[model samples]
Target: MEELMFCYQCEQTIGGKGCTKAGNCGKDAEVAALQDLLVYQLKGIGFLGNEILKQGKNIDKEISKFVQDACFSTLTNVNFDPERFVEYLNKSQKIKENLKTLLGNVPANAPECVNYTIPASKDEMLKDAKKAGIMYDQNLDMNIRSLRETLIYGLKGMAAYAHHAHVLGFYDNDVDNFFYKAFASTIDNKLSVDDLFNLIMEFGKVNLKCMELLDKANTQTYGNPVPTPVLITKKKGPFIIVSGHDLKDLHELLIQTEGKGINIYTHGEMLPAHGYPELKRFKHLIGNYGGAWQNQQNEFDNIPGCILMTTNCLQKPRDSYKDRIFTTSIVGWPDVQHIREIDGKKDFTPIINKALELGGFTEDEPEKTILVGFGHNTVLSLADKILDAVKKGQIRHFFLIGGCDGARPGRNYYTEIAQKAPKDTIILTLACGKYRFNKLDFGSIGEFPRLLDVGQCNDSYSAIKIAQGLADALGCGINDLPLSLILSWYEQKAVCILLTLLSLGIKNIYLGPTLPAFISPDVLQVLIDKFNIKPISTADAELKTILG
Candidate 1:
């Protein structure tokens, strides 16, 4: 058999077997190598950026854009197109060159970016690529390697979000500078796990600023989100389902198709659309399409409508629905229609026409409703009711059982934790992992439902807001409150969200579904010693630990 699929990113990747050739999710050798190269280049630039910052020089917007572009490009399921990968590499290299010249110094010409098929004489390329990838300690023990991987992966996720925020005109110099420092430090063999772990926490801290920028971008641009229910039934005409995570793209589409016959439905992480005010205001903006990210292939197969992916979490499309897919921004799949950015605004008229031509479901299907619209504003508005419930002994605890999910059987642990959580404890979740139990009716403690679905993966910002709000209401610090965070991570976004939590100095977080492959042992120990990070064990055991 030809070796085309191999990957080590998420758990349950091909029988938990290391993907030695190609990723099962359509990632090939070229994409993998380029992603690694982009990461390494970011590290090199990041290190250099830190030096500039040390000398009291702030990297200019052009330089920062390159760093952000590198991070955003490497996010899982984002830039899978080879051509685009090359484009990003050239742009990144130019930024590095420009930055070096701007600072009156010069670094060597970067090696060629990684390509799909290895060249005949790849010894130098392979060596450079591997070195750039920043392997930690061929001489170190296993644990340090794992911990370093975890922290690095988390930063990758943070970088993606930070990049998005940066694009929206929000830039934090401290955060930007740290990006360089962290990437540069990875290349240094003298660094200890303690140093890396501290960096991990720093990643979390900077991520908060990044997330805050996004939260502002979304809320200010879209108005504070309110509770709005979404319907599962497709209206009786042609429509489109837009997946991935770009709110600006969604808003533009809503504007582009304002009076058209096409309707818009959200899918995967995009399900939280029903909660945003500006998006919900669109008359044609209908409800959600499928369940979570994992079900996209089955859900979209043979469906008559078009699918527009604005960001990551795209699986390889089946032939049945291949013709129906369109991608914009960083999300790409081979041979799919890509909506390009024009004059800083994406014109999606083509997408709308395609959806109309495809037509929709054969009939007005039976409508099913899924509850949503429980964003931070909605939760905070009910603070009095929640506080009253607690006073009346109607509520006992709060559990933020949220994060990305994977195919690993161990992921069932999240479901168990949510299922076994005290009946009086409220479960606040975001990202695709909520699919494990989002449909469960745990009954409300007073008027508050047992589970609150806060928008998409990026909406982890909402959960943090709620946690801080509750802490303020009780006149105590966030950690002192009776709130527990049980996170299950699968991808880089999860890594960033975890970092934001750590940056806040939030401790005793329980994380699982297998610690990251990138974290080194020494890093893990530092996390354990400093912040009491624990792996997810049995739900019963973990629940007891959280409660006690």
Candidate 2:
């Protein structure tokens, strides 16, 4: 009865407990171990990097970027290539040793992770990785383990946001510094639940700042998203479908593929790209083609054109179309072609050629329209109208049912909740979870769309701004507003967003389809007692409870 790997970070983890034999996301034991070892190596670098910082020494920005992207690579379904993780491990080894040498002499009480080194043999390295995993120390207190894993998961999510922002030439020292603080804390033996809780909340606030930095990077670099309607039909000719959440990649592809006779369709989280004025300006940039990330397998099956996985949420590619899919940035799958950035730019020649060879659809399909580009700017611009509608009793409530989605059963709660919500209520959503009910015709509430797609999960900041704007207009506290947050989480990104919400003192969030297994009973109770975090019940029941 040995465990292959233990991961409870994502909501769809096996049995609502942990993925032991293999990850539900298609990562096997080997990839999981390598990722564990890679994260452990990053910690060594972080520990010494923090020590060097304490001594007023300077570390290269490359090191910071390395940590960010490496941690990101370990996120759910981002990188499944064991060889890529091995390269990361070897790279961090030199960085860690260089930092220790620079420090000259270190404290005797430094944690073992600070001095940890990768094994020469792959077999031995996998064995050692098991020891570095979440359940390595069985004797560790359940509550402490719970909080520690929670913090680690939040950091993973934080690393994702910071990585995307960093790619856009945006950096926050406070956000970067916390990486060291939180990672080094994983080794400290004396921290209590309260200390970890405080750190977790602090991470939430920093993540908020990170989210804002990314928002600026995106909007300032491109343009504030406008209310745009996009076509969802397949058009004739060569085409490329961009997936994941990296806008820069999409921008580059849009630029390169223009006038190349290839239509560009976005998949999954990239559907929001249609709202960015700069991106959508390309006439060849057609509409979105697929639903959420979980549906990519069937959606991309031997289809025309190619897929570019720029950031994360990559599942195992089926053999039917594996050769046509390319990974860039931190996303990698074994044997798939990886596009590398040279001089801060990626060339899309290979993917473009593959897409061209595929020749796309033989003829144009019928077009259907869906509305996007409803960022905070767009929503708040109509503040007067919304307030007037509210005063006239035209709008009853606001439901912010948003977050990542997965293959977990009972996730239809989000769909049913949106369907069951009163017509007078508006269902605001962001991230891929919106795909559940986004296509359904909810009609319009006067000038506003019934379902507001507020960009990606990274744009959760937009949601926050929208909520605070409404609260301000109504002259009431955020919790007092007629808004409910029923979220369905899948990965670490959702984890950090949840932490961000809780840190703002927001309460009564109904989180499902199941709570994280990493949360001990005691820790869960604390969250319930302090924040009133409720597990989601039936959509109808919860809807009735919220209204009546």
Identify the candidate with maximal TM-score: 2
Candidate 2 — which residues are off by over 4 angstroms?
none
Instruction: List lDDT for all candidates, in order.
Output: 0.75, 0.89
lDDT of 1 at 102: 55
Residue 24 Cα positional deviation in candidate 2, in Å, after optimal superposition:
0.9
**Model 2 per-residue lDDT tens digits across residues 329-348:** 89999999999989877888
Error of 1 at 284 (Å): 0.8
**Where is the poorest 10-residue window by lDDT in model 2?**
42-51
Q: TM-scores of all models?
A: 0.90, 0.98
